[model samples]
Target: MSDTMSETNRMTETETERQEGYIPHAKQVDFSSFDEEMLRKTFPNSVATDVSLCAEGVLMTARSKSNDPQVTFNISDMYRAAGYKQTATGSCVPFAPEDVKTIVLKIKGSTSGLLEFFYATGSLTTATADCSVTGSYIGGEDWWYVMLDLSRQRNGQYTERFNNGCRIDWSTDVQKGDTFILGEMLFFSNRSEGKAYADSRNKIASTTIGKTGYGDDMPAEGVEAGYYVCLYQNKLGSDAAGVSATFGTTGLEDAISFCNSRKQLGYRVSDEKGNVVYAPYTLLQCDILREAKYVTTYARENHFTYGDAPINPAINNRAKKVSCDRLVCWVMYRVGFTDQPFTQGVVVSAMHTWSEENGFIEITDKNDLQPGDIILVKPNGSGTYALHTFLFAGAARQKGMYFRYDHGSDTRIMSHQPNVQELELPGAPFWRAYRPVATATNNIYYDRYYAD
Candidate 1:
């Protein structure tokens, strides 16, 4: 992959974020949306990530790369970022038609990886033409706000209250993973809050869905800005009114009792912050389907060499030899579960696998071999002290059960059935599984240097 491709594709993954925009909760009038003073107070300026980015409940998808060449949209992972432009205008699903006056297009994001801003507006709608406005960032400033003067668009444009359509036009090709959001194109009343309360749409789309939970104004819940956040609530006021018991543990028992009294389950989003850490199932899927293909690649590169690279060039190409151990370790480390010593002891040991010390637990139970779990192998029962490790890609076609194995060779992680020796050896090859301990609530961040 190209450096640019890797950089762009690997970043900005919205893994299992709350979908759609905000809904007024519990029959409450949205006191959240700010008027002029509140708007300025709520957002003296706009921040892209802070705001939801949908328009009319759905942010417009990429049209073409450049009719508005100044813009770029990333729709899916691994696909090339393209220039998008508006191709046609179709719908006008306004949230509140009567309150459309000072429509604000508060854009806060970058282009070509450089911070840039774009905002535009045109005339109000009538039976004839539609309202329109367009402009690029005037300054080097990558962020800015544009409060559209809808009154001016209304003054001489249309005398009647015909709903100006909120339709957008796009001619460019959208790809597989492209997902347009709803909060992206929301417009607020000059007096009311946009469906999104914040200057940006993210507020409306995901309340408190920023880097932190809810919103930043929400105090750090005893978490030093980590994925694992714990709410240390206080019961200092001593409200015994609803409580029949006084089980204590930092308000948790009280909270639980309150729910139990009503026969409800009170809970939090994450136990820690495990849900957002790279998804465990997806990570496993990659290990099973994707990592299995690397064996051939590894073998070709190493030519089955046992140790590190820089294999002596003088050695005959066919004579070069490599061990499957290196291939297995390479696959494990690549998928972010590198905890074993690169030696035979860890490979075949009933205990002391490197993963035991890392952020993983050993799965000794025979029934726990799930696909994507890493497995240590002594190909045939006649396993030797020297064993090989591979991924538990999936199940096989045998009557009882056959595990489809995948591991790296000097060239690649084997994509096909490995060269399993049917020969049996005492204590030769033992099979065991390693499962990552991270989950939707528990995760390890100390070693996770890569951006989520």
Candidate 2:
């Protein structure tokens, strides 16, 4: 055990056996500054469906059964590219569950014994996946709300790993043109804290299905109408998990001819480290992905400019038009950081104001970054004239490292692959990192921290 942030997840029982908890020396050793060639050789191209890096000698791989479709996947050095083969493995993303106290999924369908869902620890394939089935029932005519408590032990399965992600396993009963809509799924942290919310649904018609220890309140008036256009439909000829089909919303259908759209491979992210980096919280990360998809398809539909802010995303829900900074802010607000500086907010004195006055602390050392921390960006040589901001997905560099993001590249959302140390930061070329210190406010994600 070292003072490194990994202490939280890497501390071993052996260290505890000594009675004196051990923490290794703490020093900021910039690995990117190390010989780039040697670093590459040391970290050769390897693949894991769920990959996590530790500073010391431990390279952890979360495994699941690997009965993958016969399609071959082209793996590469970027590493993340390996996780992109949804067609082959049937990935239904936007299924990030970054740990939450509870997961509530509501669905409507035609038939049921149990609203069975397939969940795996690794890729849906047989090699690494830890697959299992859970049972739920239809409440009213065809609706069911499944709530799960992660705080208490579940299934009594003596395993330490938590499920990464899950999606509905469409049954043979499902036929083309049949209606199967997944209403809103809610992921909330501090589940025991939300018992009052559960009580509110006591007499509600929608909760009749929730008699299962997990809260099941589904008042018709309370439950928002299902987004019919957005609901999942069993299109003809697309029964294979990774098979494709096309459907589109009316708004875009008219704008872009609601042309054919394919199905999500339905791969949900799983968190094996107990890092709370998957599920409920991952759902927020999906917001970033969803918004990015919107921008990719409709960037032309939006107008971009600095100084202008998108309407409160909680209400407007999407950035109609936005500058790079506004896109970051819109996402922060929508991810449940309802406090200002983000929600219903605007840029303040460039990025520093938010990092300083608001609760975010700018990181002086890149190694200190945890997931959800943000790195600031500006045009080359554009000192203090900070032009952009995006969520930090992970670190990939040793010196001033190359990090990744599913966010704004320039003005439009794209993949993140920037070196913080390489970016221009006014004085020297040092990168600036800022993140809200972990704290709970009326907002749930008030101070989000990745697994330490």
Candidate 3:
């Protein structure tokens, strides 16, 4: 982006005088009702000429130049930075720096570019920002969320710079004529709250329902309740005694013992400091489902390419084309399973070989299948090998023998189908199942049979 300004390059004479005698205000700015006046005041030093308010939000057109374009939001008013607006008539409330942990930006209709965030004090023309973060955005017409973590500022000394305003700089990767809509802007006190807000708007479905052995159907014997039980016990500590008791287990140890007896098919346990202590299944199925939602949504919205060959020209597009194997590898990598690379020409056989090389064990019996397991479809004839592969979501609702799975294929490049759905195959024997390994390091799990 732009070079850091020096004190000599501060604001104009009039603006500098206002800054010198300025008194802090406890009033906040209402972003929902943001108008042209508010927009101009927020970015007094912006060089772009075409900044206006649209139905979606604020619209800004990048100027053609060598230096990167920038839009800085003046947060000298701590209340505004904290996401609280001053009423027409009410007591002025104050917020400390620690009260806000992240600044979230909702953006839409932008070209491929790098968005960088920085914190600055004093005039935008002169102040130097010591803290900076960069995030990438794909060129698309859909809305996406960006969150900047302020908690990591200056080794957790973010509170010391509470009054510093925030600046957003866009890299030249965003073309000159490209335009983007700046939607709702807000501040949250924690990462979970920010993520929740984005997840709500993004329409991410919950993975807790429709599972046989989890959620509301958790057994009284606590056999299939390992995920929730471990999560609660780790989060609650001694307070988890009641939860364990209610589940017919004495304590965390009892629940863990039951989980271990099932061949590490339960949830992974993490310590208070966020370190993984016991990882049953490489990662939680719920986490895998969450990442799947984002990946599928992104691919559909961005019109991801589709190809099968090693060096297909169609794959050269801005959003590279991917086969079913590439899609599966992408989802696994997103959730901390980085054993394989996202390469072209990755076929079902490659995945099978990779699983074998890793600790993933083969499961001949369908009853041993669990959520997040990889199932390779048996070849059509005796001459060929397994051709199609998918991620098992859960057992289907029907009694006979059907299962839900998340699938990705050349046909689903633009379609939203194969989004955690169930399909009736010829029979269960048509597919070969592979269970992930369980270890404290890998955090894999494999559970057998759904009990009533």
| Top-scoring candidate (TM-score) | 3
Among these predictions, the greatest lDDT belongs to 3
lDDT per residue for candidate 2 within 231-327, as digits (tens), equals 1111113331111112111122221211111101111221111111123223334344334334333433344333354464334535454555555
Each prediction's whole-model lDDT (CA)? 0.31, 0.34, 0.48
In model 1, which range of ten residues has the least summed lDDT? Answer: 75-84
Worst 10 residues of 2 by lDDT: 258-267
lDDT of 3 by residue, 28-119 (tens): 23344576666676666665435677877777777753235776665654233333343222211233455666656677645544466666
> Which of 1 and 3 is the better model by lDDT?
3
Please give the lDDT score at residue 27 for candidate 1: 11
For 1-452, candidate 1 gives per-residue lDDT tens digits of 12222322223222111223332210111212323332222222221112223322212333322212122221111011111121112111222234444343333322211111221212112112434432111111232233333544545544232232122222111222222222123344442343234344331111111223322344333322222211212112332101111111122332232222211011122212223222223434433334434443445545444443332211222434334444444444444443434333233333224556554667766466665566665544453232555555443322444333333343333232332223223563446667644433232222332223
What is the model-wide C-alpha lDDT for candidate 2?
0.34
In candidate 2, residue 344 scores what lDDT?
A: 43
Question: lDDT of candidate 3 vs native?
Answer: 0.48
Ranking by TM-score: 3, 2, 1
RMSD of 1: 20.5
